[model samples]
Target: MTGAWWAAAPAMLVSAAILLVPGLIATAPLRLAWVARIALSSAVSIACIGIAGVAFSLFGVFFAAWQVVLVALVLGVVAWLIRGWVPDAPRERVRWWWLASAWVLSALLIAVVAFWGVASPEQFSQTYDNVFHLGAISHILAGGDASSLTLRTLIEPQRAWAPYPSAWHSLVALNVQLCGVSVPVAVNATWIAVCATVWLPGVAWLAQLIARPFESGRVALIALPLGTAFGAMPYALLSWGTLYPTFLATALVPAAIAIPVAVWPPRFRVRVGRAVLAGAAGLAAVLAAIVFAQPRVLATWAVMMAPFVLYFAWRAYRPAWRAGGRHRRRAVTALVAAVGALVVAAGVGFAYVVFRLGLFERPLDDRLGGPQAKASQSVAAGISQVLGQAWPAGSTGTISFPSIPLALFVIVGIVAVWRGRRLRWALVSYLALAILFVIAAGADDVLTKLLTALWYKDRYRLSSALPVFGVAFAALGILVSARWLGHRAVRRRTGAVAFAWGTALVSALTLVVSGGSSAIAVVFALPAASAADEVVSVRQIQFLQDVGRIVPADERLLGDPWDGSAMSLLFGDREPVFPHVNGQWDPHRLLLAQRLGEIETVPEVCQALDALRVRYVVYNPHEFGGGDPIGNQFFAIHDAVGAGLFEPLLTDGESTLYRIDQCGRLPAR
Candidate 1:
């Protein structure tokens, strides 16, 4: 019950925060849209400044402050260019039905991601780095003293010496403390839930924005559902923290695309405030940085939208030069200010890079790194085969899923384009981008040479483009179905019947190909699945959750970083005992699990685990076979220590936990 309550706190607090921000803006004395936009943009700007400053202060990363300033400046330039683009229009009333549908659909997807999906092996195993760090963090949250925890923990040592950023972990800890819950669970749940809430709103909100230019509820409804579905995947939302800024960075992609399209400029009378487009870009840059701390997301964003950026710049420049009066001067000032801001931001970011990376070097040296030849390689190949063969299999069934309304909408979108609707060009452009990404991502060489330089190496780099494709497909479906029903030659009921019957037929075909009734049932059952409240309570699960909390914040606790990070938010400013990234660290423990019986050398295995100061052995039974000797040896070791080598902490049938004794050992480093 306590665990459940702790989990609920953050959700409730976020809900409250969401209401407060808009309410305060709405009720302001000179309430106007630009006021809200500027305020949010400014707050985001300041936050970035604070984050970079924190990094600099703690790690002596001198150029961190400049990165924040650089991003804000660039956004200012973009806004100045687009300042007058918004045309005067009446205050549009919010469409409740559209909003309701979007929220409902997104909520359903969250449930599926949270409950139905299998846990990830790559991310959720023991003997991975970050495990002990999270365990130590949990201990601190559970009432372990932080001063001792930090001094005694491996994560803290990593924080001081290694280049890992503490922003995400620290932020989660702060939220958990404020919510007054078990820091570990609340922090974990908060990351997962917040990722869904923040990004999904932007995704669905994009539909409304895109349809604004068209002024069609049908278009908005069709597009928003597709966006919601794109983010609903189990892997996307729940895989936070473990994946770090990548998930957060990916979430920002849609928002980067949407702000220019959706956010209406303030009425022309208010010339002092930032333009909506500028504010949007600024916010996107800052948010993108918060996750990955990578400058590339912003650069890609600017590059991708260069045409739009250029158009706005032209609008601002052309009018000012033509007016040749006070207006011309005002335009000149805005242009100068904008350019100045971008220059400043760029300078700051560059300086920070130089300070941390020894004169603007990449984290990893520029080498072929090596091919991904394991299961990851296999998965990449599978993804390639799906694209090459399945794409040409016919657009008819490639995106088909057994949902009636969705099927009809997709069909309509396709037909609407085929009939030479004016919107077809935009749809075509969107599809072109998705197809390009899918194709470019397939070749390991191409992926390594291009995107992996900016981002990490992953075939799933194509995932970002999926949402764009999803919305396009959904739009095509809706347009085609609507046209068929509205044809003048058909009787009204007959036309409606034709649309419904055709939709059903297509849906059935999709179900047949998608593994028959079970897959179909799962798809349809998504919305009906029960949504978990703010907190979920499991009996023994809370042990790991609490143990992570109670360990002194500075105490070094070793465990699998992969699974350890799931609830790591509770740990106060700690690092994972094992470092997972770049594979530069040792992996003897993992090898122990892999080659348990045939290893013939028990002493080496025990010595490695001990040397790592692995105080807690968290064994995920799901990943290890029952007959594995490492599992057997672990039990034997625990028994030898009166099972005192580890205190039996938590157990689900799927996972087991044991707390390791210090054994009179001193902290590493």
Candidate 2:
């Protein structure tokens, strides 16, 4: 594992370059403040990756490392050519040391937590969603295509092409190709890099924007350390669904929202025409990145920006209402028409997403009613969970304690910002998300589905987004409290040294009560041995790697995906008949899954295996989630060896590899 950690160094460097360099170069023409440029770089880089991937795929070119570099250079050159066209926004001249110190501290804290959580570079979350994410990266490498438009072909071959967010997959695949690391190593290292480089700085930038009228630099410093204090975000998402795409997109939300805030009327002081153009361009790039990374995040972005939109709309209405005489009726009518047009557009967009795009249509599962039942029992508990940043929804038992320190800070922050007109928007945005989370967590009805349909009404998804705004509020609270304490100390004739000690003591107490470090460890801990819930164990992976060496590349293996065999694509570099836990599998694959053991008894079984080119089988009976019901379809395959239809090729105590001799091998490619 130590070697694995050392191996991740180059992978992390490659990830940082892939995630940052292009954006930094391309956005140079915008002439933003250095902090603003750095904060938005990841979004720009992701946009470049996704666009380039689709372009390469369209042209039948390989999407490899050199291609990625070439795309970055091309974007940089285009941006440099337009340098004179886009007007420069005002740059705040904070001391370089202030940003440097804050970034270094934030990066260190985040890296420590991320590294400790991952435990090893090769380690990956064994959760359900990882099946698709890990396989998607491998699919990109295998097919030489990383386009979001065609990524779903891995699971939905019948469609041949479907729109699926693949920006995260593209970045990881590029890292693996450039660094020569395995998929798991690339995934873990890239996540760590994104958190430190993209997420922390992005949030700090948002805090600076929100507190711009006050000591903005000091607020950023206060916010940076607190970025890791929340449990719902980078940590919970990492463990729960292993939602790699959503995690990456959510990291950019703060920066994405900041673009509009910086450019909107009443707040922005720049010349309207040039500033609006620049802001709109930047916002478009970030939104493209968000859509590519995860389309679901667009809803989250819209929710967070709702208050700013209302504020802008209000500003537009004020002058119309105040106009004199004859112009008043015309101005008011124009304003009403504009507002109506916006509402109609929103309605159409919602319909397109729900019906035309066909996303977030999953119905609720009734089996897991305990959590929902408990949550619906008390709305107050749901509110407490959101404010405290306790995540994975319904984690209100003795094992999942609420963060009293965070809740108190958020309450204080709400009170502190209640009077400030601009900063109060943060409260409004936070409250909006908090309400959505409460609805998703505490209700499972028609209204809940209608409101949270974008997120499939999944409480975990809703809860994971709350911390995007919660952390800033908590940091603001701490900043105000510290300033007040220092003022009181000066008034009481206490020295600066006493104030410093008091702040240190209070910070330490807060950290302890928040349980930030301990909570991360608990959530990210991977199983050391094969468990019913865990997908694969250390020994199992070693065995798979060994089997990969002996197996021919041309032949595919048949196995129950729920038994962790789907991971063969990632760990063994060998294709599996089914690469995901669930999908709209074709009839032939379904027949093999249910009746592969009937090969001798049923002629169709042999024909199905032959048609699919599957000459080998992996029998790992330890199904994930303790014999998940999905694995029930493959019970016949599991009993094939005992039925004496499979020839033993290899074994590692519990898992075995068998050759299906009855199904004659297909001709070599």
| Every model: Cα RMSD to truth | 10.7, 4.1
lDDT of each: 0.40, 0.71
Return the lDDT, model 1, position 373: 13
**1-669 per-residue lDDT for model 1 (tens digits):** 123333354444553243123323322222223212322332343334335435344443333223445544554554446546433332324365644554445444443333332221111212222343344344434432322213233333334333333333433444445555454444445444443444444444444444343333344444433543332122322222134334444545555655554443234443425456444544554453333322334533443344444345556777788989988888788677656655675565455445643433553344324321111323344444333212211111122233545434644555555565434434554444444344443444534333333333332333444454345455445445555557652343234334433443443344335432222122112111111210112322344455556554554444433332233333323333442211234455444333322223455654555565545554332211122222332233323333344556665553455654434353565
Backbone clashes for every candidate come to 49, 0
Q: Top model by lDDT, which number?
A: 2
Query: After superposing candidate 2, which stretches have Cα over 4 Å from the reference?
Result: 1-7, 81-92, 114-118, 266-270, 324-377, 389-405, 486-531
Model 2 TM-score relative to the real fold: 0.88
**lDDT at position 538, candidate 1:** 37
